[model samples]
Every structure is written in C-alpha cells, then in structure tokens.
Target: MTTTELAPETTGAPTRPGLTPAGLVTVLLGAALPIIDFFIVNVALPTIDADLHASTATLELVVAAYGIAYAVLLVVGGRLGDSFGRRRLFVTGLWLFTLTSLACGIAPTAGTLVVARAAQGAASALLLPQVLSIIQATTSGEKRSRALGLFGATGGISSVVGQLLGGGLVAADLWGTGWRPIFLVNVPIGLVVLVMARKLPESRAHNPLGVDRLGTALLAVTLLSLLIPLMEGRALGWPVWSIALLIVSPVAAVAFVHVERRLERNGGTPLLPPSVMRLPSVRRGLMVAVPFFGAFGSFMFVFAMTLQEGLHFGPLGAGGALTPLAVAYFTVSMLSSRLVARYGQKVVPLGGAITATGMVALLCTTLSAWPHVTILELAPSMVAIGVGNALAMTTLFRIVLSHVPTDLAGVGSGVMTTNQQTSLALGVATLGSLYAALSASLGSRDAFALVIGAVAVLAAIVAITGRRLPDPRA
Candidate 1:
C-alpha cells in the first residue's frame, strides 16, 4: 500500500525508522509492570491489614484507590504523550512510578499507604498508554502483528505472575518486610527499565492538538462516579453516598459523549474523538473486549478467594494453583499471530467457545469435588481457559487497532485500555459481589460454581460477538 493510503498522517517517506528489537523488548517490559502491580496486591492484602492495623474498609481502599486513579487519568496520559512526546512521558511516568513504589514500601500508616497507592496508580496511567502507542507508531505488517501478540501475552501472564510473585514475596518476608516487598520490588525493576528505555524511539502526532480540559473533566467524573461506588459499595454496606454516585454515573457518561461529539464537529480535538469510535473494527473489537476481559478479571478475583478461603490454602498455594493457566496462555499467545493469519476472524469465536467449555468443565469439577478439589484437578480446565484467552485477546488487540490511523494511536490506545480496565473493575465489582453474597447463603462451593457458570455465559457472549468482528488483515 502507498504511504498515503497506509497512514494519512504521513507523506513521502516515514518520519522515523521502525522500532528496533531492543526497543520492542523495552516497551513490552514497561507494559508488564503496571498490570503486574494491579494483581500483586491481592495476596498481600491480609498481610497489610495485619501489619498496619487497617480496618476492612481501609483495606479495600488500598486496592480501589489505585484502580480509580489509574483508570481516571489514562486517557489524559495518552493525550499528554501524543502532544508532548511518547518517550518523554514514558520516562517521566517510570520515574514517578519508582518513587511512589518506594513511598508505598515505607508507608507508616494505613492512610499513607492508600495515598501512595493512588499516586502509584496515577504513575501507571502515565506509563501504560505509551506502550501501546509506541508499538502502534513504530511497527508494521508482520512485525507489528508479532509485537502486538507478545504484548497480549505479557498482559495475560502478568496477571497470574503478579499474584504468584506477591505470595512468594509475602511468604519470604525478606528481612521481616512482610507485605512491603511487593511494592518495594518494583523500585529496582522500574529503575532498570528506565535505564533501558533510552533505546526507545520517540513518536507523536504530526499535528498535535491542545488538551481538551472539559472532556477530561467529564470523563473523570463519569468513571469515578461509576467505579468508586462499585468498588467500595459492597464493602461499605452500600452507603447512601455510594448509591448516589452510581445514580450520577450514567448522566456524566452521557454528558461526556455529548461534549466529545460537539468538540469533534466544531473542528476541535476531543479527548476521545468520535471519529475513531465510529470505526467498525474498533467498535466491534471493544464490544467483545468488555465481556472477555470482564470474565478474565472476575475469575481471577473469585478463584483467589476460593483457593484461600474455601480450600484453606496459603497465599503461595493459592497463587501457584494458577500456574497451568499462565503457562498455557503464554504458550498459546506466542503462536497466535500465525494462527490469526491462517484462520482470520474465525479464531476469536472459536476461542470464546473454548473458554466457555473450560468454564463449564471447571464448574462441574468444583461441584463434584467441593472441598476436596486440588490444583492438579483444576489444571486441565485452567489450561483450556488460558489457551482460549490467548487466542481471543491477542487477536482482539490487532483487530481494534487495525483501522486506526497513526496520528490517532495514542487516543486509540487510551480508549482501548480504558475500556479493558473499566470492564475488569466492573467484573470484579459485579461477579465478585455476587460470589460474596451467595456464599453466605448457598455455601462457597455452590456460590463459586454459580459464578463460574456466569463466566461461561460471558464467554458465550464473546463467541456471539466475535462473529461480527472484521478480520484485522482485511
């Protein structure tokens, strides 16, 4: 294809050389850190509560604060990268993340840790969008497909590794550090990545637009209104304020959309351009992303609880139980590009079907074995789900970005990541809440089985939706 047809943002030769092998590795390393941190705290929460004497509500805030801050600022972070420089923002974000992690490690009180965690989330917001934007801007054709596939694999594996690493760190309690090591460990790794990041090439929009302050405000308000309540409501006994915020969420969302559309029509850049959202590929890919990621997030949360609370396994054992899943996801993700090239869009629905089958099998196994179920028994189903997730998500990333122009890479990445992150939080809120509520009445085994069954339904929805996605190659 001609340059004009390939990327309207450029004319003549491309402005910069493609990303080097070292640069690809650097960006992918940066990408994995934020996702790992998100899940690493799951196994550390109890230890933190005990060490800091935090109330149950405060413990929840440790997780919610990070999530809310990260989700709220993501698009703005992406915009900043596009307007300034992706490399500049990436370095800045990594620096901030390192400092905040130190703060979290040494936090003297519960309130201090909560604030530090929120700041860490903000740093993550600044860091993550740049990874996807960089990949989009710096690679193409088979190389692009391969890079995106690796990125997908990194994300899937990081979630599982986070908990596993967290458990190991907490169990080791290096020098009696207890849960502090989880956050502290990021410091050395972040510093190392910052040094390596110098190899990365900087890329940004050729005609960058000014930040949309109104759009930013509205989007933040919308997300905070929805996410905060869902994240904290059940834990706080569904207080009046939480209920009120939930009521306000949709109104803010509607206003945000209206303002964005108006800005685009008036010949101005909005935080999220309606033009990008209108792409058939972007639209369809995101529709499937919601349920697929939702199921993934909720399964991780609930299964962690099942292993620890129901089976009375320690943190290490609980995290280790997921090994089969992680291995399968990584192995499959490595080969997904070739699979997609051969099968086209058909791979996505097939992945969803496999995921649903795995979930059903898991449910059956849980119901039959109940309290006696072992990791060995869970391995087969976990592998199936992992393989399915690898196939679906790796291709889904390609499908979403397939039609986006280079000038809009940051916006597109921001939009996709925001959708994925929001869906994950919602999944944890909705299905996690269901499991908690039901476990009280129906018992843990039955409650878990019911929730897994729901996840199967979600996978089936993904299967149905996947059929509508256009092939990325086309």
Candidate 2:
C-alpha cells in the first residue's frame, strides 16, 4: 500500500505552525533526557548496589526494567502523540519524568527504586517520540534536514554524556547523596525543560487512529519475552523460565504481525502498519540499525566493565576515558548533513569501514597492552569509532524518515525508535553475555579483544548493507 492510502484524514486540527529555533532546542532537550538516563546508571551501578544492598539479579533489573519499559511503550507513545497532541504529551511526560526521578532519588529500598525506574522509563516513552514527530510534521527542506541532524547528534552525544555525567555525579556525591544525585539531577533539568516546552508548537495526526489494544498487548509480550530473557538470563544463570521466554518471543512476534495485518485489512489503524514495514527505506534502514545500534550498546556495556573491573579505574576515570569519543561524535555529527549532501549514500559504508578499522585498532591495543592500557592508549580508536558512528547514524536517521508522509510522522518515528531501542537491548544482552562468559575462560584482555572483533564484524555488515539504502535526496 502507498503512503497516500495510509495517510490520516485532516479534519479536526487546524494548520500547525512551523517549529521555531527555540522549539527545536526544547524538543531536542526532551530527546536527550531519556537516552542519557539509559547510560547514566552504568557508572553508578556499583554505588547503588552498595547503598541499597541490591543483589546482582536486582541490579540487572535496575537497568533492564527501564529498557524493557522504554522499548515496549515507545511505539504506543508515538501513536498517542499523533492521536492527542505532541506538545501536550511532551509536557505531561516531562512532569512525570521529574517526579519519577525524584522517586528514584529518594527510594529507600532496591525494589522501590526498580519500580520508580520503570515509571521513569514509562515517562521517557511518553516524551521522546514527540521530538522526532514534531520535527517531521512541522519542518521541511533544509530546516528539516538540519533539525534531524541535530536530533541524531543529540542522541549520540547523550549516550556518551550519560556515562560522563553519571561518573561525575557519582564521584561528587553532592550533599552526601552518593548515587542518588545521578537521578536527582534530572529533577531540576526536567523542570526547566517543562517551562521551555510551553513554546513548542503542538501537532497531531489530523485523523489519528485510536490505540490498538490487542496489537499493543501482543507487541509488549513479544518484546518482554525476548528482552527479559536476554537482559536477565546471564545474571540469573539462564534459568528454565528464561529459555521458555525466548521460545515464546518468536511466537508472540508472529501473532503480533498477524494481528496488525488483520487490523489494517479491516480498515482499522494497527499499532505498526505492515505498509510502513514494507517501505524500502524503513526496511533497509532497520537492517543497518539493528547491527549498528547493537554494537553500540554492547560496546558501551562491555567497555565500562573492562575499564572498572579490569583496569581498576574509578567512576571518574572510566567516564573520562570516553571523552575523545564524545568529542569526535559531536563534531562529526554536526557536520554530517553537509557530508551527506556531498557524498550521498556512500557516507554510510565509508563510516562502516572506518568503524571496523577503529574496532580492530582497539582489539590490537587490548591484546598487546592487556590490563596496562590507559585512556590515552584507547583514545585514537575511540575517536575513529565515534567519527564513523556519527556518519552512519546521522545519515541513517535522515534516510529512514525522509520518505514518511507527514500524516504518518508519529508512526514512522515510533517504528524507527522502537527498532533502535530493541537492537540496543539485544546487543547488550548477547555481546555482554558473551564477554562475561569469555572473561572467565579467555581472561579479561582476550575476552575484550574477542568482543571488539565481533563488533568489527557487525560494522562490516553495516558497511555492506549500507549500500542498499536509498539516498534521501534521490
């Protein structure tokens, strides 16, 4: 089916205003918060365990709960934004995020903190999709391109910044709060964003589809069955339930597809329309997104462990080590639009090649230096990886959403974000588990090298498949 057939009717809402410079900043800030929160806890995990007496299993939940909730609800959040109003949901989400952050900060028990983190994840789901949806609906031509570039940069920078900020906050332990401040810091920032969000011009699908209850439930089950097992299986020793959930995941996924298709056939709006999935840009873009983001997630998780556990780096030291990566990613991402305009689709494969080269450098460094490696030793490889990632990711975002009709902007954004989020969870689960298991047999240095090698292979796959993406300008 063509996008025109799938476009929602424009009957209720009046014409929406274009996004202003200030509005772009407001939405981008909204986008950054959830992504930053996802990685921020990595540096603070040890402190959280010590302070709350959290068990290893419970500690995994601290991360997994947020991710699972965030990933599962993301598409639903987008649909809600399209149905209601993007600005309204954005503001409400910020309010809830602030309160949930406070809840996380003050929780006395590990269980309470886990629950609060899940709520915080839910709040994030409500907020993030609007960032892209608003930009898609309100901006066009060069303005849209630049806005998307900034959005991509925000996401990439936020992931690194999350770790950096987590380390800084945990080390400072302001007012004797220890790890609490990592979450508490969001309270004030969220409030300030809430005020700024007032300036965001509201937009929604003119004839938005009602939420698809069955499709939502099936999608949640599909994700939970898969993610819960991967995230918790390694820590919990691959229990029977974990294996069972893995089996159920594919079954639930098949059912989800059947349900969504049937809904669309019957003239109802499905949660994720098959038409969107059939779009070549969406399909090809996702092929790259899966491996690219999977590697990204695993690299962040495994490298943090390697630094702290192997090299005995403090939180500050570990976070500081990634400084080169953050710098390169921001610098390159800012320049990516112009690069895409000049180089077209060639940029992604070139990025993949560069990323593989960087990973290989990292692998060699780990093998040669072992536990003696320092931040300076890792800087060159990190810089290479960051530059390549910016090229691929920034371009991929533009390519994926470029063809989406404005009427389906929320759905398209949701589909892309959900794919990205799910891949991240899978990467951390699979590669992270591989690293842990290998560390015992191969030793930390070899295990890390082996994982980096695997990541390099994933980057190679991205380079190969990136050739298939249609250039947005075409």
Top-TM-score structure, candidate number: 2
Q: Give the TM-score of candidate 1.
A: 0.87
* Deviation from truth (RMSD, Å), model 1: 4.3
Q: Cα-based RMSD of the predictions, in order?
A: 4.3, 4.1
Q: Which digits, one per residue and each the tens of the lDDT, describe model 2 over residues 77-157?
A: 767887788889889888999999999999999999989988998888888767777777787789978987777678777
TM-score of 2: 0.88
* Residue 130 lDDT, candidate 1, scale 0-100: 79
**Runs with alpha carbons beyond 4 Å of true place in candidate 2:** 1-25, 49-61, 108-112, 133-153, 156-160, 196-204, 440-442
Off by over 4 Å in 1: 1-26, 45-65, 107-114, 132-160, 196-204
User: CA lDDT, every prediction?
Assistant: 0.79, 0.80
lDDT of 1 at 160: 71
